[model samples]
Target: MDGVDLGIEPGCIFGLLGPNGAGKTTTLEMIEGLRRPDSGSITYGDHDLVRSPAVARERFGVQLQTSAFFELLRVDETIDLFASFYRHTLSTETLIERFELGEKRKAYVQNLSGGQRQRLAVAVALVNDPEVVFLDEPTAGLDPQARRNVWDSVRQLRAEGRTVVLTTHYMDEAEALCDQLAVMDHGRVLDEGQPQELIERRQPGAFIEVAAEVPITGDLRLPGLERVTHEGPKTVLMTQRLDETLGALAEWAKQEGVPLTGLATRTATLEDVFLQLTGRSLRD
Candidate 1:
């Protein structure tokens, strides 16, 4: 976080990505007015965030990683309580329907499943009808279907022209939802760009992956290979000159008497970009 000499465009979904304790949450907290930066400025639209935080709050919606809603309160009661803080709010009926909480509207908050609780928090965020929304790990620990549902609401937010700033460790979610993003590590921005553009910049060559039962001992310095890296049983080779690399590998496989196993070549992706930027797997 070399101070965001950056701005998240209105009506855009901007993702902040990093591993745990990399300061992604810190940066987002500062922007959401949950934590103050030790020495920097945050301006939200025309409001001076430091000087007029209340004004900024009137326009900001934030969903923290962990919510502390009253466990004994009904879903409608929780929504109503939060809505009372805002100048304007969507009706409880509409929020419940939008979040698919209709069947559970009268249920206690603590009785809701993890995914349901997450959705309730999202619904609470929108109660203010703010101009900007921040979601921190909105779908962490969720099942596949639950994650997809969360994504659907985010897409709906984009369609409604609301600015969203999301912080998540999941690379696939960043690729799917973000138009522009910054990857952070150790409280610093390591890379920033459109996901596809970043991938192209990092790996212009084809990346072939090989997971061998045996280790590759020697450095693979062939005529066509551009880069070689190994992690445990996995190895990735980058090559612009694909034909030559594949041909040489075929010859070497025969000569060395090693089986070519778990070999695959796919177009580069955001995961590759993260790997190139951080020198580690995104999930690591």
Candidate 2:
């Protein structure tokens, strides 16, 4: 119920992702030494994470999917408290500016917006100047701009030579930040690879999205199409041979006297890769 097999490498953002109850968090916790695995080994760089947990704790910064902080304490004060635990800490003024918390530094936790609180949480995690960072759904509830802000901070971590172990349901986020990733399900790793590699392996052609009021049945086979499926009134075709598929689709439409008013084609993505492997939606 609680173990993982992650062959992590340094200077990489490794994403371990899954739906609820998939043990993603548990796997991360074990690696971070926050919880003991029932039976497994967690080696980070040269340190045995489970055997030398004290060493692991000192080398990593942690941000849980959800966190609670002192509502009465000011933002800067909260960071100061966590800073006191470590031998070295980032300057309060620098951290405040880094996370764009300068204005809210004196504000109590309860008064901050959902996004502000998340930034503060990240600020506190980096207070220790850790070599690796574990961020679980760091931008889960943030708005678009706030999410981008968090993404920028993550890039800075990588530029600073800090490894990041992250988990997120946002497929785009994984593509944007991670050097490699693993998609999990039912407490097992379903797929793992670089974002580009996974997409290339799973699908090779541009996605042609065809929306029809009627069923897309009756032999509307497109050339180079490996698969065709329905989502609501839309039919998606995935194929490496797009020219043949498009020709076949055009003929099929003419023969059936059907109109694909919303037909669109675009490159494959991490989201498409996940759907091809899982056969289920990420939000599912």
Give the whole-model CA lDDT for all candidates, comma-separated.
0.85, 0.84
Candidate 1 residue-wise lDDT, 62-87, digit = tens: 89888769999999999999999988
Give per-residue CA lDDT, model 2, range 1-284, as digits (tens). Answer: 53446677777888986677778888878877889876878786677878988877777899988868989999999999988888888988888999989899899999999999999988888998888899999989789999998899888898999888899888889988889899887888878889898888876678788987686885555568877878788898877877777888888888888876888888899888777777878877
**Which model scores highest in lDDT?**
1
Candidate No. with top TM-score: 2
TM-score of 2: 0.93
Alpha-carbon runs more than 4 Å astray in model 2: 1-3
After superposition, candidate 1 runs with Cα above 4 Å error: 211-215, 255-257
Total backbone collisions for each predicted model: 2, 1
